[model samples]
Target: MVFKRLRQALGVGGPSVETVLANPECRPGDHLEGHVQMVGGDHPVELTSVALGLVTRVAVESGDSAYGTMQEFGRRQVTDAFRLDPGQRYDVPFRFEVPWETPLTDLFGQRLSGMTVELRTELEVTRAVDQGDLAPVAVHPLPVQERLLEALLRLGFRLAGADVERGHLYGVHQTLPFYQEIEFFPASRYAGTINQLAVIFMTDPQQTRVLLELDKRTPGRFTGGDGFGRFTVDHATATHTDWPAQLDTWLRHQAG
Candidate 1:
């Protein structure tokens, strides 16, 4: 009897948790509304807290090697400490605000390759943490962001893949530890000059900043090298600008 009581006290049959998002689709600077549905186990348990976090996969460079791991960039508390009675059903609703720097996982109604974003649920019982299953969340691009992408496409750049890196970009102000890079394949028109490209977008409520990096296929002493440029403008200005023309001009200058 003592062994059985010990197992139960150790959270062996504490409680089961399942999180349900009202709508799993969101954009940066948007809100994720959901509820944490929980059921009491074989006996009553003391709950410490419940929370939600925005999580993504990031690539980390360790000297000569690189690896991928999951990281949470944002978190919000759902409920405080409480006692859960056996067979009781308790549902905690939440509205987690997605940060403006949150990485993108989807564009044009399609999921990007090598990209993933999910909501991580954590429940603590008497100081012992119990992590619930991850709930998938699809983060799409904002209007200005979409326009930037469309401009790249119109300039004949093919969408490749995207990944989050675990470091900072120089000269760019960022609140998050990691940033995302959207890669692209060069067009035939720029055949031997440009091999590949990567674009990074940083935006806040009022303005958007863009960084363009190119993998040049230069012939001389520089075989395959990288060149980059940056620009910042308000949302209205970004929407009005001719992206294809601007990007084309910039590419020509870098390729020269």
Candidate 2:
């Protein structure tokens, strides 16, 4: 009997989990749900609780390359303290409110050009120690966001690279700890007039903060071309709206 109980406590009976997406392609400010299962071991053992966390891999900017790192964005307890007997098992279900400003992993049903995300699980044992990482999940992007990217490409912006930088925009209300930056090289037509353009999309369910950083070449008069032109844009625009016209206007001003 003791051995049976020990087995139960030790999770020898195994555990299973199920996750459901209320709205997988959420813009931001959405909710997600999942269920956890625990089976009894050989004997009855006092079980603690179960937990789930949303995790993602991030890269901090170094000199030439990005430094890979991991961060936990959200966590929730799914089960209450309880005890399990030999050959007995229980299923526990849970729901989690995904932060409205959760980063986008994909765009318009297609995975983002360069981003990955996963959901991790943890199990609390009777001894207060936590065992986790049973599984991982993938997050994709929304349609409207895809359209915006298409527009940028259509305007001749070439994707240089992308990265997630920690901190707030100099002049924006940002709730998330980090923001995504997709950069581009000036198209050949504007290369002589512009150096490079960096685009940042700060988003929540309600709005997106689009910031444009333009570096202009300084014509050398007496000495040589020096200095650079820099600017930024922050507009509360919905993703569904057309942006090419406004973007073209911004690019023309920068080129001038």
Scanning candidate 2 in windows of ten residues, the lowest lDDT window is 1-10
Model 2 Cα lDDT, one tens digit per residue, 177-196: 77776667877767887777
| Candidate 1 worst ten-residue window by lDDT | 1-10
* Tens digit per residue, CA lDDT, model 1, 37-81: 788888988888888888899999999999999998788778989
Q: For every model shown, what is its TM-score relative to the native structure?
A: 0.91, 0.70
Query: Which regions of candidate 1 are displaced past 4 Å?
Result: 1-12, 219-224
Against the correct fold, how does model 2 do in TM-score? Answer: 0.70
For all candidates in order, the CA lDDT equals: 0.83, 0.58
The residue pairs found clashing in candidate 1 are: none
In candidate 1, position 83 carries an lDDT of: 88
lDDT of 1 at 223: 42
Best-fitting candidate, measured by lDDT?
Answer: 1
Model 2 misplacement above 4 A: 1-26, 43-45, 61-66, 126-131, 134-144, 193-196, 215-241
